[model samples]
Target chain A: MLRLPPFQYHRPSQVEEAVELLDRYPGDAMPVAGGTDLIPNMKHRLFTPGHLVALKGISHLHGIRVQGEELTIGACASLTSVAQSREVRTHFPALAEAAGQVAGPQLRNAGTLGGNLCLDTRCTYYNQTEFWRRALGYCLKKDGTVCHVTRVGRKCVAAHSADTPPVLMTLGAQVELVGPSGSRVLPVREFFVADGVWNSRREPDEIVTRVRVPLQPKAFHGSEASGEVSTRVRTGYAKLRQRGAIDFPLLTVAVAVALAPDGTVTWVRGVVTGLGARPRELTGWEEIAVGEPLTPEVVEALAERAGQQCRPLENMIQDPGWRGAMVPVYVRRALGKAVKQGGGGSL
Target chain B: MAPTHRIVRLTVNGDTRTAGVPVHYTLLETLRYAMGLTGSKQGCDKGDCGACTVLLNGEPRLSCITPVWEAEGLDVVTVEGLAGPDGALHPLQDEFDLHGAAQCGFCTPGILCSAAGLLARNPRPTREEIREALSGNLCRCTGYTKIYEAVEAAAARLGSGDAERERGERKEGVS
Candidate 1:
């Protein structure tokens, strides 16, 4: 029986009009497309905007197009469409995999990539019903001033729960954002901020219009022979959750790596989500595995190093210590699966 | 403040109907209360339970959290609409009966719609894909082995040309 608080709903026919509506309402309004995330949050009284600018009426924000070497996915494109898209599956399999693994099939059918990318940071303390929150004296994510995750901190410490950002970051994606100042494209990695109070760097008036990703070689090699020339960079996603479906990830790890002709790792990029305030890319890990031949010992060592660097707090569904322990396990598993899939020529 | 009402037009179960619904009313409420299409159950209104699943523009979506206004101009197909114009059961519904997929019957409508959407897109999905597609829809009564079998049977029946052809072959006893 959860219900959205009363509000004025406006359907804008264009992105410019949507931006103008947001600009007009300022802090009392929010834009909604899929409403997969926002509606539920609103019912729980997490956010009570007086006005909601519906974005589904914008025709230009509903299609996927490829221009030259890059693919532009409209912000209003549903997660199901994005995951099942031939172009997305063919060109950006990691993104597709990430999308496919979000909440579940039902949510994916209605939720949009824009909604997922712009997903509000989540915390167990912040996601409860208003009654539960009031009973708990309200955390800093909503009404209070002190962070429950870091008791002394003045800001909220909600974890970034989006599953798509890590994979997008691994692929070097860019997002088009429109605001009163006009449109600008920034690296997807730069869109998120580590601070929980303000999880995104985009202005309140800004609307993410499109996500453009440059095409890259397919990571899965279709050959069975263990030849070096046929070896391609491998990408994989591994999520840790209490249940196999429907629940958000307790911790997620995405790994993309390039191997040299002799099987030595050339480059490695590791991204972790559902752990901290935002998804973080581990840059120094390349040096740890670049020269090594990805043996059991080497993978374990690199995984341990990555796990040691993650500072998981008691903000998500699982225990902080258990989630921290799982970092290495998931990291190793994702990298191992990617390496195996790359070498074995299977998706 | 008291809730304000808005008039919404919805095409549900092959008929067009209009109702003055509160802004907070979801598509689930509109279907169950306004149009009397109560086949779509409300298990977990939070979208965790897929009992409120229905087709919005031919794609399966959670109707519980979906606002009624979002369905203003869309074709909405509910579990009640799965029957033919003559009111015959859908092949999936028939297969559910044949395979004993319905236990409590509370979760059947949602699972049926989810499977229908899957078979519409992929006529022959692998077992893993089937599991993944129906992961959102939960069934607490049957162990889900029977439900999966019913979907596979429905897919085979639907993908093999015509229903009459399958029925005639079944009558011919070709196993």
Candidate 2:
């Protein structure tokens, strides 16, 4: 039986008290919401914090609220709740789909959005028991000096495999964090760093308070000229994983597009994740789609351009070449589905 | 000497229960070791496996990852609590037995709890919904075909009982 290392647990009833506890312990403690990710990692000896500030008691840090054109989801809201919420399903169906498909239903019922957004980077070599890791002489992520993924690499090459971050990036979301000093918000896209060793920019003392999802701009309601240019807005999210039952995504493609009244693509933005440590927003999509209807040739050209940005190293189970090949195929499929909806896709 | 654990109060299966658990002791460990309710299996201590599934306030949750303190004051329903006052099996249990859903029986309890919760919320779930609801509960024994049939049968029995109760109440109102 794999057992977690003993640690002192502290329960705080409010978010303020939770941050205060973090302030007290600073480097010694970590805040745990659902522990779906943390406990498993703890058992593997990846994280052995001396103190864990339990965030379950903080009532304010739970629930989803929608006001006018904005959606605010508390950090402690469980993935199941987000997936099952009627409003989220209506306005942000992509988020709901991503949340529902994360792992399995049991994990979704306990895993929180804050935890999912801040999920630890994953790798086959680094996600093993201490004894197993010791036999392998460890890797850059844990008690070793060399990165097993690429022996010649100087830093860890673990992959960021979270499902929601990529979808959130497509929705243009922002994350709100609070610490002993104050609070700050960062764009969801900027929160991730390309370096595998330092996957995120979250400070040690900061606790993610909420994730703010701005309202999708209604196409025809804005300025007359821009409205004429953008007659509709739509988005689609597709994931490639080894198993349909539940597993971390092997690759993910999220695309959002705006179309003119005649169905000519006015603007397009796409991001690809699970290919590397950071999600790269595919460039040249706007140039290819704008002023041109979503013709098959343009879609194929955009997909090929997007595939050029992925650096699929042999860090996962599938062959890197095959995984890289699927990048364009999945991107084209996702965009084809998004355009097929006639701008009725999940925005 | 190891330090003492904290006392966490819970309402399990309509009864008040208490246990002394370390801060790190998940609800699965507390129920099995401290409270003596071992029906919920601990297949994958991680939330990936649904063997430790139970109802927290009528919703199925992964108890293996949930801390004992987080479940305080919630109505926790386990497989052991599924029988009636006279020790008769719930309709779901009877259906499972009729359909031969369990080969090894380790995954049955968790599946039962999850199916019960699903019936409580959505009595007439479609086949797809049933499959989606039980997707989290992994059973390598029966290949899941028999399990789905069993849950569908149980839902019918439960639905009939609910209709009968409502009819009885309507007759009383008329009188």
Candidate 3:
């Protein structure tokens, strides 16, 4: 039986108190909301915090409310609640799909969006129990400085395994964080760094309060003569896994495309996760898709270009080569689905 | 390291009680050892196996990872609570027996609680939804075909239309 090493558990009722607790404990304290991820990792000795500051007691971090043109979701909202939310399903269907695909129903019921977003970067070498890790001579992620996956690399090359970040990035979301200093909002893309050792930009004393997403426009009314143009956005996500259920994605792609009235692509954002140290937004894809109708051939070419952009190392559950090879397939499928959903392609 | 003793107060099977539990003990251990409600099996003390699943505040949560302190002031429903106050089995339990859903019976308690939570939320769920809802709860025996059938039958019996009318007729004939 796996057991968490003895520690002090503190349940703070508000975000400020939680932040203070985190500040007080510094490197020895970690905040946990759902414990779906943290508890298991604790049992495996992946994390050995002297204090566990729980965020579940903070009632303020629990609901979803939509203001005029923005939707705010509390960080502590359970994945099940987010997945089943009417507002989320209508405006951010990609996020809903991603939430529904995480772990399974049981985990979703207990797991929080904050936990998923702040999920520990995972690697086959790093995820093993302490006994197994000791047997394998501790990789760069935990006790050692050398990354087993890449013997030449000086830093840990663990893959970011969260399913929500790519979808959130495609939707243009911002996260609200609170600390002793005050509150600040940053675009979700800015919250993550490419290094696995320090994935999030958040300070140890900051608590993620809520996530804000701009509401989709009411109608697809085209640009007027006055030059006010409403962007026609289409988005889709595709995840590659060993099975259809209960496993994390080996590789996932999120695509959002804005199409012009003439059926040419106006803006494109492609985000890929579960392959590298962090989620990456593939740049220079708009140049590939602009002025051309989204066709199978065009999608294949773009996917090939996107696949070439990724440098997947051997730190994943599947073979790194297979994971890299599958990038184009998933990218093409995601782009094709997005184009179809956006109503930008010829029937 | 030795176990630190703590008093944990929990409402189990519709009753509130306090028991002395180890600080490191999980809600699963508290229920099975402290309270003697062994119906919730301890398969894979990790949360992956659903054998220790129970409803905390009417939601299906993995109890094995849940700390005993976490269960304080919460309503916990386990397989032993599926019967009525008079000890009659729930309709779902009856359906499981009727449909021969329990072969080894090791996974039945968890499956029952998961289904109960599902039916509580959506009285009438599609076959696919049922499969998806229970995907986390594993059943190594019976190949899951019979269990799925049992959940469907239970849903019909609990759902508000033809099955309710049929159950009413059965009650009248028995009286």
Which is the leading candidate under lDDT? Answer: 1
Q: Which segments of candidate 3 are over 4 A away from where they belong? A: A216-228, A340-347, B1-3, B160-175
- Candidate structures ordered by DockQ, highest first: 1, 2, 3
Global fold similarity of model 3 (TM-score) = 0.91
Which structure is stronger by lDDT: 1 or 3? Answer: 1
lDDT of 3 by residue, A40-74 (tens): 78888988887888898899999988987788899
Per-residue CA lDDT of candidate 3, range B47-163, in tens? 787888899988988888786777788899999998878766787887787778999999899999999999989988999989987888888889888888989988887774443
Ten contiguous residues minimizing lDDT sum, candidate 3 chain B: B160-169
RMSD of 2: 5.1
Which residue pairs in model 1 clash with each other?
Answer: none
* Model 1 misplaced stretches (Cα beyond 4 Å): A216-233, A341-347, B1-3, B160-175
**With candidate 3 superimposed using the best TM-score fit, by how many Å does residue B103's alpha carbon deviate from the native?**
3.3
Pairs of residues clashing in candidate 2: none
List, residue by residue over B1-175, the lDDT tens digit for candidate 1.
Answer: 5358888898887788999888768999989988788999988787888999999887889999888888889999999988788777788887787788999999999999998888888999888878988899989999899999988888888888554334444435533
Q: How accurate is candidate 1 locally (lDDT)?
A: 0.82
